[model samples]
Target: MSLKYLKIMEEIKLGLATGSLIAGGKLPSVRRLSQHFSCSKNTVIKAYSELEKEHLIYSVPKSGYYVVAEFQHRTNENEVIDFLSAGPDKNVMPYLEFQHCINQAIEHYKEELFTYSDQQGSYSLRVQLVKHLQNLQVFTQAERLVVVSGSQQALHLLVSMPFPNGKNNILIEQPTYFGFIESLTLHQATAFGIELSMKGIDLDRLEYIFRNNDIKFFYIIPRFHNPLGHCYTNFEKKKIVELAEKYDVYIVEDDFLGDLDPDAKSDPLFSFNPSGRVIYIKSFSKIFLPGLRIAAVVLPSLMNSNFLRYKFSSDFNSSALSQGALEIYLKSGMFTSHLKKIKEVYHTKMQTLVEACDSLLPAHTHFSKPTSGFYLSISLPEHVTAKQIVHMLNEQHIYVDDASRFFLPEYKRDTLLRLSISQVNTNTIKRGIEQLAQCITLIDDRNDDRKNHPIPNNLFLL
Candidate 1:
């Protein structure tokens, strides 16, 4: 399908954003827009019609279209600078395009959607996934891929299931994805932690842990790690996989944000050991539609049956409708186009965030400098806690995450803060950092004051 109309829609949206097109302002006539864009009148009409459907604009009986008056109110900002939300940017989400896909899917698979589906997910969707995985350097066939509700479900299942290695414990990075930590807690599984920083983990420590710990599998987010946004180098990934093989330990590679990696030369851990020492999990939640709850996991063929049994107990199958719609979206090449657009958008946003941090943060503060990812972490000064910063920022309607929950109990620290670039307005990033720097300085000063002037022990008695 031609995306010329989408371009037209984007131009109008940009106008609205920049105040060039005010609420209730009359829009250019169909003929004028067609002449300006050098497109057909029907194309202009279609663009306007779509905007009208979205309630961004309306048409009179005989007059030109006008922006919806209430649109101004919706777009008006109350000065909320959000760094907590980790979802895709609301402005760029292809909701309308996917809505079309949903309609097409219902018409194509109306009979199959409501009934029970294959416990391993739809075969047709898996085929499309096979093709999609190739883009991420994960070479696998549909036979080895299992579609799940999401990557979280896959991680939860792996945490509880018995691995082929027969080892009982799980090993993870010290500060990892919180959802996975929650799974470990609920299952009461024995887990070991390896410290990770922007520089990556210590290979010697990892080898020692792998050899000593009765580790079943190492759960790793190889790209754009949650909270830390730390991505491993190709050499590190290859070594990790080799060590896992040498130790008879399995590797669960969660490449959730791999699609957004700017390094085309970088390969997933699965690519290093395609014969199945590594299990690859890809999540669509970060870069694509999250509400669909769709993810694909490439498992070792030997473990597929056992994994399916566990999946069967969780839910009969993932949403068949979601699978069907995603298949069409992939087959139609919409997903590829969407990826191209978002890749640049996120890369630019991440750069902006890092630049702001470098210029605005205090000298005592340290932060990760990821090339392109949704998160950038800040290490606060000693005696300055993430809770203090989070609470202070909340008063100003600025939001950020406390990274304490991301750590295992034994490795917990209170001075780490995570700032997500996904949902924050790109224009407001510098301002948010400015406020955050002030908060950190205030708390650091208070700590200094307390040390210099201690209250006397007898003051309370008096």
Candidate 2:
């Protein structure tokens, strides 16, 4: 609609909000309103019709339109106990620190903030990232780094951009980040999933796929992998870099949660060869505020120009104000201190989940404990399905992600639950876990196979 029609709606809304229009109060007739506003009568009719549909007003055939009663069409929802989200908790955000950084950024670069920034990103932020990457075992200068809106954007660019390899096949881990796996199909790209072992993906299988197919790249979350929460060992990282070099393929390493815990044992895939083959992407929104909208991708020297060109065309550049604030925040030395503080909180929450799972979950259930990050993978009995468990859990007001989604449809029957205590408070972990255990027991009790998997009801409480 035109601005004039929009203005009419805004005036009516204002009248309602300011108490000038009471419930059931009559509104001006279409003919009278049109004359008063100097518009067509049809325009007034259209406005009234739209407002009627919105439940803000109602029309009587002869009396004309009248305002409706206060609109409320929602029920009070029950509080949810979440074990699914991997995003940072909002209640404990360092709002003051960020506000200070934003204020400082506006004051220091008042003029620059309004102008268009470099296509790649703010150079000052990229330079600061060089020092930051050093601590993460990656050493790259600003020229090799391109700031992206987030890891999702980097993943899209990598997936869609032309690869020198003859084939468009990409390799990923089975039961990987389902969100990424789902979107890969959008490009009509062929993808192969390598089964993840205790340490990492099977080296023998990875090499076999590389030798057989003209693979473009191997997308991986080597650090704090989602669903599995498994970090590749330094030995595995070296072998991965070596295999990529041998097969002439690229490795897109998503170190989104690397900063959450600086476990020295698991070096990044890029650390093996900074300039060789690894494409490293770091997500700042994970550790910092979610709206930071700043993630840097350190491209292989040969691929730097290609990625920069693609990013330039896609978004022109990421939010410079966010980049500027982050740069100031880092320079203030608060980023490190904030990391230290949240590391402790996340560690404590993780421990609580582990202890609860150990005591409450069934004897046949198996899981892996993560050193850092907010994920744990639980393998349930073959008799149960992740979807069934998720449905039952939801009924109890507990939320978790079904690991079935992380795998391809053919492998979806695999019964696993990817639980993360990232959103739930620490004190609620035991209760939620205990409730889940009861639901599992109830399922067993309803089945004829209850005798085979006998778990005392009191055992979980003990």
Candidate 3:
């Protein structure tokens, strides 16, 4: 056997000694063990067979392997918890109902589901989406709607389809969504970053980029913008629309998290620009259930023909069954009820995070109070990089998004971190924040000590 296989067997032996792999307990399949050891099935089988011969384990026909005898002691516990990413809390998901919906959709729409759907999405779903948009005060006719896999795909399609040539550039807010930057880069399109303030994107920098570049489109997440969690002011929204019109630049408005806004009074960019210049995208994933993976884009009537063609070439269509189930969910008013439940839960969670930040974070560390959204971005001391903080926190099993990932390579802003409040409850938020605070304090103290006492090269020479 190879040294590597021997090493894996040794580890397995240690696991057995420590009672980590309990007796009478089923071991992972040969394929799984092979993957874990980065070895072949034969190698794993050899090891298992050796163990079995030694009377350590027994294999049953068809059922595979199991431990032969019980061990006396307990094993070490796994002590890792991820906090940096945001998704629906596993505890909160309505799994039973969601599963029922999925099964029903599959059984009922089996024949039709086998084929490709309409590129612009199912007609029935589009109709429901139109109504949903209308509810959000984003009025668009059914013909203008294009269903996409998710908001990410919607953004990708928009980034790819709207421009006539690859040479055309798009404008984005500095420290924007990392995924957005990735999508823009994939298209080989130049991205101009406008500096952001607490209010929103800096208008002067925005104007400069517009005047200097042959920008084809400007993408903005006006409400509860990713990372920053800053909502564009009503005046700023108007200015953005006016600027887009003046510069003759198309605006890709991502209203992905707008549904969770506590105050639904604020209007979207689409509300201002009913014309084709503003393309509005919305996602039901965050608010409802992510497994649905359903999102819609409001296309201008002028671009409908071309957009439809482009969409067809991409995915043929969104899932018909998902669309059907979503239609039922939307019409049943369960979606709205779910939204209310989510808002209530998220609102409390956001408040808890805010309070934690106030109590736990250093006086020097500063963050904005977000009116709405799942996240809050804090600006740290320039000397303290978000990457360093993330690394430190991750060692303690507390994960956080480093702000640098969101910016363009040329645009380096390291002293920022985004804290997502969506996936965790208020109770857990306290402990997570406390751990995060400890990490920050240690980093800051290390930096202070470094400043006080610099290492001398002469010591190395001596």
Candidate 2 per-residue lDDT over residues 248-295, each given as its tens digit: 898889998898765765678898987758999999876877787789
User: Model 1: which ten-residue window has the lowest total lDDT?
Assistant: 70-79
TM-score winner between 2 and 3, please give it. 3
TM-score of each: 0.92, 0.78, 0.79
**lDDT (C-alpha, whole model) for all candidates:** 0.91, 0.80, 0.77
**Model 2, stretches more than 4 Å misplaced?**
1-79, 197-199, 450-462
Considering only N, C-alpha and C atoms within 3 Å, which residue pairs clash in candidate 2?
Answer: none
lDDT of 1 by residue, 1-462 (tens): 367998999999777644578778999999999999989999999999998887889999899999987544232345678899999976678877888899999999998987999989899999999999998888989999999999999999999999889899999997999999999999999999999997899999999999999999999998888889899999999999999999999999999999999999999999999998999999999999899999999999999999999999999899999999999999999999999989988999899999999999999799998888798999899999999999999998899999999999899999999999888877778889999999999999998999999989999999
Q: Per-residue lDDT for 36-64 in model 3, tens only?
A: 88889989888787667656678999999
Which of candidates 1 and 3 reaches a greater TM-score? 1
lDDT of 3: 0.77
In angstroms, how far off is 146's CA in candidate 3? 0.7
Total backbone collisions, model 3: 1
